[model samples]
Target chain A: AQSVTQLDSQVPVFEEAPVELRCNYSSSVSVYLFWYVQYPNQGLQLLLKYLSGSTLVKGINGFEAEFNKSQTSFHLRKPSVHISDTAEYFCAVSVSGTYKYIFGTGTRLKVLA
Target chain B: GAGVSQSPRYKVAKRGQDVALRCDPISGHVSLFWYQQALGQGPEFLTYFQNEAQLDKSGLPSDRFFAERPEGSVSTLKIQRTQQEDSAVYLCASSFLAGAGELFFGEGSRLTVL
Candidate 1:
């Protein structure tokens, strides 16, 4: 079975500060990684995905993530974040041949002004 | 609407009652999915449909939960004799690709069992 782990339950950061949300996964077969953001009272939106090719995947809103195969981790990062960037971020994993997405517990990012 | 739309944004029902939530995916979409999102938790896969056929329903929790996409466009998730644990947000998503691609999600139908 495939599972995703997001250790941090909540993260608090000051505006314009660097931030990183950790994500780790365990799977027996090849897997795809994704990051989705959910604003308050809204549906989840795709931030970025890593299917294949380069590991350094960049997404909208100046966010990027590095996929480390050895560590089995795909942590999302941003050089500087804004107050508007505060939202609940989810890390999901999908098997190579299926559309099933196993999501983590989620990390709530709070940007303080 | 251009995006996925779900009916009854909020639903409240007593325990042991039956409830059905509807989802309308984007036009011409081939893949439709249902996910359950508990409060303070991430969304979990419930079932998946490719066109009019249900390809993967292994994620469904139990037989009490049923979903169908008859025409490959609109889907309905029905809960029989809903329990307190069934209180969660039901989200519907669709993708043009068959199996693997970005998913466009709906606002979700929040079910509250009292």
Candidate 2:
């Protein structure tokens, strides 16, 4: 079985400040990592994903994540965030050989103006 | 092109009532999935379909919950004897057949059981 863990339940940051949301996973086989963002009343959108290439994966909305295989971590990071960036973020992991994705509880990012 | 779409954005049903939610996947998508998201929680996998065949339904909460993708283009999730715990947002997603593509999601259908 595969599982994801997001260490932070909530993170508050000032506008234009850097932010990081930590995520870790436990899987018996190779995995693919992904970050997704959800705005109010909207469905989740892909933020970024780490499949098999570079460890530093860049995504839409100025977001990125680093895949650390040894640590089993794929933490999402943004250099500078805006108030509009306030949303719920989720970290997910899927086995390399399968399509089943297991998602973390979620981290609420509050970018205060 | 139109993205994954779900109908009946919101549904209110009685405890014993039966309800059905619909999903229309992107044209040509060969993989479809169903998930349940409780308030403030991430979406949890409910079932998965490859083309018109349901390949995985291990995440379904109960036998009362059923899903079908008869023609491989549109899918439906049906719930019978709804319970309060079943009140949640039902999300539908789709991807390419190769199984290495990203999953596109729908806005989801919020079901409220009374």
Candidate 3:
């Protein structure tokens, strides 16, 4: 079984400030990790994913995440965040060649202007 | 449609009543998925379908929850004898196939069971 854990339940940052949302996972086999963002009343949109090579993966809207295999972590980060970045972020993990995706509770990012 | 479309964006049902939510996946999509999101929580996988065949339903919470993708394009999730705990947002997602590809999600159908 595969599981995802997002450490922070909420994070607040001023506009143009850097932000990082921590995520960790436990999987027996090789895994695929992803980050997704959800607006107030909209569905979730993919932020980025880590499949194979390149520990660092850049995503839409200037967000990025680094996959640390040894630490079992895939933390999402953004150098500078805007007010529009305020939303709910989720971390998910899926085993290779499997259709099941396990998601963490979620982290609410609030960018204050 | 350019994206996955879910119908009845909002539904309110009394306890013990049944409700059905619909989802229309993007054209040419081969895989469809259903998830349930409770308040302030991430979406939890409920079921999955490959074309018209239901391949995975291990995440379903109970037997009262039923989902079917009759024609491989459109899908329906039906909840019988709904309870207060069943209130949540039902989200539908689709992808070309289960791989490294990203999944496209619908706006979701919010169900409020009183």
TM-score of each: 0.97, 0.98, 0.98
Q: On lDDT, who's better, 1 or 2? A: 1
lDDT of 3 by residue, B20-80 (tens): 9999999999999999999988899999999999999998999999999988899999999
Query: Residue by residue across A39-66, what tens digits does model 1's lDDT show?
Result: 9878889999998899999999999999
lDDT of 1: 0.93
lDDT of 2 by residue, A1-113 (tens): 88999989999999999999999999878988889998988888888888897999999999989999899999999999999999999998888868798889999999998
- Residue A24 CA error for candidate 2 (Å)? 0.3
CAPRI quality band, candidate 1 = medium
- Ranked by DockQ, the better of candidates 1 and 3 is 3
Model 1 pairs whose backbones collide: none
Instruction: Please give the lDDT score at residue A111 for candidate 3.
Output: 97
TM-score of chain B of each: 0.97, 0.96, 0.98
The list of candidate 1 runs beyond 4 A from truth reads: none
Worst 10 residues of 2 chain B by lDDT: B95-104
